[model samples]
Target: MKKYPFVYLACTAAVVGASLGATPASAGHMTHVVHAGQSIQKAVDAAESGDTVLITPGTYRESVTVTTPGLTLRGVGRGVVIEPAAAKAAGTCAAGGNGICVVGTKERKVEDVTLASLTVTGFTRSGVYATATDGLTVRHVTAVKNGVWGIAQEGSVRGVFRGNTARDNGDAGLFLANTISAEQGATDTGGTLVERNRLEGNRIGVTVRRLRNLTVTGNHLTGNCAGVFVVGDENKPRAGQVTVAENRIVRNNKSCPKTARLDALQGSGIVLTGTEDTLITQNVIRDNAGTSPLSGGIVLFKSFVGTASERNRISDNELSGNSPADLVDQETGKANTFEANTCQVSRPAGLC
Candidate 1:
């Protein structure tokens, strides 16, 4: 990964200046109203650090980039739409290409924004890309028909994504990648809380890679190719300590060819690969039946060589109405517990 050198320089300068007893006071708050013939970027450029850009109800054909810290861009109503300026710049003829891009450092918090009643669509990549931000709250946002993920966050810490609706995206509805380089022996990413989000009709509802200390709770994931996929490998050894609890995973079946039988099909309630030391509790995994026979309610595949999934708990889950299988496979690693689960299909008459 290419290190953001200018960002590092800016952060270092800010830290040193802060250490020299020159503590920078919080920038005063301001608000800008976006109007016709005025671009969103121009408004952002004119506003100070801790300002709010109130976008009026209109269709704005622009791609906005938010580099300012502690800023909240709010739309008045659902009519506020931001799309790519032109097709050539984003390499796609879609209506909206990469809706809002946020790049911030560690010092500031991106908070208190109600991104509601707006429709973000037709992005070439992701609808929103938030990088290196903290305390960022994305609530009640609607992302639809994007080429890639609806929402993507990389290296973000302490962010809350709640009540957001993501649908018909090419890849996952919400993609959270925590692959930041360790600085000063501390990981800059992780500690994110994703809850109460509605993700449907995407390739995957949620895909988390190379993350730790993530809490995905109370999210409704349905009608996707895969409900939730947790992937880790030798390269990402520390992708553990994640808590996947209280989420409703259901009906994530995708149609596939008949030749791929006995292979876990596109729809899986929860697919865990090389994931260990995690808590999978109180989730409702059901109705994940697709055309392929490899489909299962919950699957645990060993992706890493010589690595086994151990000490993981799968309890109190209502696993029923799944295709191909209802529970664990033989290849899955051992020492995992399956207790108090209401499985429609099981080995013995009672719970195993």
Candidate 2:
């Protein structure tokens, strides 16, 4: 694991700034307008690279997929919605269908795709799911009330999911799973940023797994099972260099649920399980109470066999009034280090 010595905010902010500075392709590219009753899938299928599929205001009932590169699917205004195709209450796509699925693979990698200013809901699976796409951007969108995650990405690289609202999903609001099947080769996802978003009313707010060089900052998280989770122990071999900073994570009051996902940790601002090379700092973590004594502000726990959540740091945060304690640790997690954190109660209290 490469030690990310630079500040997370600076690095990601620079990248976001560079993206903002680049010229958008819509200026000279072809624009296809899809009316409310028209087929967005047809428009996307007909679109070429650097083309824009502009959706007008109204609710469309269908699942949209993007396979072309350098394409932008943007709503004209706030009222554009992609709801579950009412014909089949389960959705029109195959079982476990998402609202929008942007997919690619090593053989044919999609690049420079953007989805913006739209609302997607009522999918049986995630609202928006992207896999194996590079240079992906999801901004100013709303994903809500999906069967599972609001937005989910897997095996992706160099992505930005910012300025969005993700809430009321069955599972996590935003999920990043980076490990591909070993048969595909040992490629760990990298260079992703999740920032300036509102995540609430889900099982987990931001659920991260096995993504390297990720930065989560300037987000508001509340009313969820847990605010942020940096996971390891699935034994994929790489989950590192994650930074959670300058966010407000408070009052995530739900307990762990008994379901197919089998969530065992909840009611915490941040939970670190079998991770490494992470930094949590400059955030306000408080008022998260749950039924479990293990629920609290920051937890460093382990469940898997490798890496052991070591070389992680927590510093300069305001933590208080979480149920049980402000900081909790279990199962050989003393390898993590903390510095100058403002907390009154911590399990193994000497760390405070």
Candidate 3:
């Protein structure tokens, strides 16, 4: 397997603040610098809106919670690490077993918070978890060996997850859902972007559940049980209107047993269930071979909850050496089109 270095997009502090709708550093914004052996939470607590908490290179054994809007938490170098706390804390985030939490309320979203250039590992639940936030950017971070998710968000909009590495997580490496607590209609993410990330050795690379208006592009995913899963169920405004394009997905043959809600999964490049108007195009999927029911290069599977997928387009993708045929459409839905694909063999014939 080829490894890709983390791509760093350099920006001035002023430029980053402006993009997040925060006060510029030149305009009396404070930067609270914390050295090794110092408490990052102390600096974060002292920081006001638009202030920045800059962490130096060291391992921090504490869970960090950021509720202040427009606050920036950044590490100076790649050696910054955050692991599980030594003792249990009273904070909601630490109690919930997450490394970092950016939280807000339903009526008031924490806006424009940034987390960059750090490694969060060995958390019981998630590495970075966020909810009720807007314009949140997470970049160049590494999350590994988390029990549940690597980087997860729910009930948020306008999120940008770029240039990150998530590996060996128990669940999806990057998970975005409308809400995990209830069954509801899909929510619009207002063009959230998941791009240029490396995800491997997880149950799934990326899982977008009950979300719309997002794009998963330019990602490299391999050695997971499944690569990308766009999931929906029987609900109003069913999940759709998302794009999966220009990704490299290969050799995801790790087997995972059947869960309560899903069957066994392996060798799935991109799987769509109970979605409509989704576009799966221009991806390179190769050498994924398995015998699971969901195994294929690009599969349109029957929804577990009996919701049909309709009007989705699968086109112009490059696929080779995938088992159970390259393209498998088990559902007989309306107006789904497959055209102009480069592949050898497809289930039910003529799709390739």
For candidate 2, list the clashing residue pairs, or say none. none
Higher-TM-score candidate of 1 and 3: 3
RMSD of 3: 7.1
Which tens-of-lDDT digit does each residue in 175-272 have in candidate 2?
Answer: 98864344221235566889999998988999887767889999999999889988776455557688999999999987666655344556778988
lDDT of 3 by residue, 157-208 (tens): 9999999999999999999999999999999999999999999999999999
Better of 2 and 3 by lDDT: 3
Candidate 2 local Cα displacement, residue 17, angstroms = 27
Candidate 2 residue 147 C-alpha distance from true site, Å = 0.5
Using lDDT as the measure, which candidate wins? 3
- TM-score ranking, best first: 3, 2, 1
Question: Which segments of model 1 are wrong by more than 4 Å?
Answer: 1-27, 90-97, 105-117, 180-190, 256-265, 291-294, 304-307, 330-334, 347-352
TM-score of each: 0.79, 0.86, 0.93
Q: Candidate 1 on 1-352: residue-level lDDT in tens?
A: 6421111011111212222221223445545656545677767766565666666667777677777766666665456776666535532223335788776666654543324445677778878777777777777778888888898887778778888889999887998876433411113344788899999999889987767778889999988888887766555454667788999998898643333312434768887666667788888888887644336787666654544565667777878887656665534466766787778774323443
TM-score of 2: 0.86
lDDT of 2 at 221: 98
